[model samples]
Target: MRVIEAPSPNHEPRAAGVPLDTVVVHYTGMPTAAQAIDRLRDPAAKVSAHYLIETGGRVLRLVPEGRRAWHAGVACWQGLSDINSRSIGIELVNRGHAWGYHPFPESQLESLRVLLADILARYGIPPARVLGHSDVAPERKTDPGELFPWRTLAAHGLAVWPDPVQPPAETPPVAWFQARLAAVGYCTPQSGRLDDATAAVLAAFQRRFRPKAVTAAPDTGTAARLMGLTASA
Candidate 1:
């Protein structure tokens, strides 16, 4: 593979004794791939991903897979912390929501699949480990949003996809929904009330796993999907 040069200075050696087994995917969320690349390379920005896949499928390696890139900040997964040291980060190029967000190109996704397959095979990353920026940091971020083709990646065995069954028409109780979401590893509070934070987390979960319907409210369909995902995981 033709490797690109490092584009960011905000990285360091992986935390000692931390086993690397996760891969976090993200979108540049900038106006253009070039601009995103520049920002990642800027030391003052204090942020960088291991790889940046451009719209036409060009893959740029900003940081070595073995090092800790500053991609996932203040994140958590599966009760584990320090996600930066435990995951490989891939930043897909896209003008994100703030700058006229658009669908990721087919070529870019194909490249992502190929890269993810290779990474998974080499690192032995579990299906649940293949996640999004929002999955680890739901409160502060939403890049690689609902439009991301996670189902396509799942079809290629890169990630997990919840069942397509929609829940019954009558809305399930809030407690039932919160419990299911919490079971799925989301940072959902135990409170039965569906507050804004809960909605954000639910929306983030839907954006990653159940893209077809991502309403903030815990409808029957979202609840059912969350239950299926947790069970399968």
Candidate 2:
């Protein structure tokens, strides 16, 4: 793999032999890739990803894959609190939801697929481990939002996808839905009430796994999909 290092001074060594098992994908949310790169390389910014993929499909290495990049701040996954120590972070260039969020370009996605395939193969990261930033910090972040094409990634064996009809219309009640969300590693409460936090979690989940229609309410299709995904996982 040919690479050029644009080293950032914002990262450090992983907490001694922490096995890498996750891949956190994100968007720069800036107006341009150059600005994103500048921010990432700025020590004062205190943020950096191992790699950044520009809109034109250019991949820039900001930190060595073996080192822990300071990207996933205060995040968790499947009981693991120190996510940066166990994952490689990739920042894709996009305006993000805050600005004029748009679909990722074709060239960029193709490049992303190639990079992700290599990473998944070399590290043996599971399909379930390929996740979005929002999945790790649903309460505060939502980069690589609903516009990201997760289904395309899954089709190439880079991630997992829920059944097209798992949570049939005749499925059980809200408790069942809540349980499935929890099972899939979402920080959803089991209260059976679809409150704001619950809705945000559900939306984040959909944005990563579903990506077609991210509604707040747990409808028949959404419930079925969540149940199917949990069972598969």
Candidate 3:
């Protein structure tokens, strides 16, 4: 795949012996790609992604894969913090929720598919490890949000998508949902009640798997989707 060099200085060495096993996908929340790219490249911003894919399919490399980009700040996944050291961040050019949330273009997604395939193969990253920025930082982020076509990526083996399943005859409790979500790699709380933190994580999960309705309510459909994902996992 062709990529343009647009290196950023906001990176540092990864922690010793850390394997880059995760890929966190994000959308540039700025109104324009130029603004987003400029901010990422600026040292004062102290944030950069490994790569950025533009709306028209152009790929730009902002940080070397060997270094830890300053993305994924204050994020956690599967009980692990310091996600930036363990992940490669790819930013998609889109007016995210802050601007005008919309679907990703086919051109952008095509470039992402090619790039993701190459990254996964080279690093031995599993499809399950490919996640949205919201997935890792549920309470603080929503980019690469519900509009992202995860099912399309899953079709190409670049991501995970669960099949539809029937909800249990009797609706499960909050702890059950917590267990299933944690099993699916979300840093969900195991508190017996649906607390704020747990609700945020559940909303993030719904943003990915049940995009049509992200009410964050522990409804039957959401429960079934969680069941399907955990069973497949």
Candidate 4:
């Protein structure tokens, strides 16, 4: 991991006393890396991340890991808010959902594995705490999109992967899904119904662990995966 320092003036001091224990992955989502880099560096944009990985595997350092980069806005995870205060944000350069989302290149994934391992060593970020931008703010964002290689990350010991499980004949109720999602570290909706927010959370989970089915509507397979991951956690 040779990192190029490409500083951005869009960060602020992290909160007074917050332990940086989480890693949030995102996709640049612009037409090109240069445009995304410009947006991140522009102070008026009020957004930046600790680093950005280009498609060809070049790593650019935008903000110091010690400061808050204002990457996550209106996001939550496991009942915690103000995520930017306690997380390291890494933007993977890809044209996300809006611009014809595509699979991440092998070069990019290779560099991400190295970068994540280095950051996790310093902060001891847990596998379950390695999450996507969509994981924290499913209702507002989807980056490092469904096409991202989460299983590859898990194979490298950078994140967690659920073991295969047989789903019960009947799909679990929405309330059950909500409970299990919460247990698996998501900020689930407590409404006891299949609301959009809850569905978004479920989709995020599937994107991470069950990319085969991302319906957002709970199914037997989704339920089984959720149960397995929740139990493992």
Q: Once superposed on the true structure, which residue ranges of model 1 sit more than 4 Å away at CA? A: none
lDDT of 3 by residue, 1-233 (tens): 99999999999999998788999999999999999999999999999999999999999999999999988999998899989999999999998987898789899999999999999999999999999999999999997999999989999999988887898887789998899999998999888898999999989999999999998878888889887787767
Best candidate, TM-score: 3
Models ranked on TM-score: 3, 4, 1, 2
* Sort by lDDT, top down from the best: 3, 4, 1, 2
TM-score of each: 0.93, 0.93, 0.98, 0.97
The 0-to-1 C-alpha lDDT of every candidate, in the order given, reads 0.85, 0.85, 0.93, 0.88
Q: How would you encode candidate 2's per-residue C-alpha lDDT over 1-233 as one tens digit per residue?
A: 45567999888889987889999999999887788899999999999999998888888999999888988898877757899999999999999987789999998998899999999999999888898999888778998898888888889988878876645757566677777777887767788877777787878887776678877667777776776677656
In terms of lDDT, the best-performing candidate is 3
lDDT score, candidate 3 = 0.93
In candidate 1, list every pair of residues with a backbone clash. 7-41
State how far residue 131 of model 2 sits from its true place (Å).
Answer: 0.2
Q: Count of backbone clashes for each model?
A: 1, 1, 0, 0
lDDT at 165, model 3 = 88
Where does candidate 3 have its weakest 10-residue lDDT segment?
A: 224-233
Candidate 4: which stretches are off by over 4 Å? Answer: none
1 or 2, greater by TM-score: 1
Q: Higher-TM-score candidate among 2 and 3? A: 3
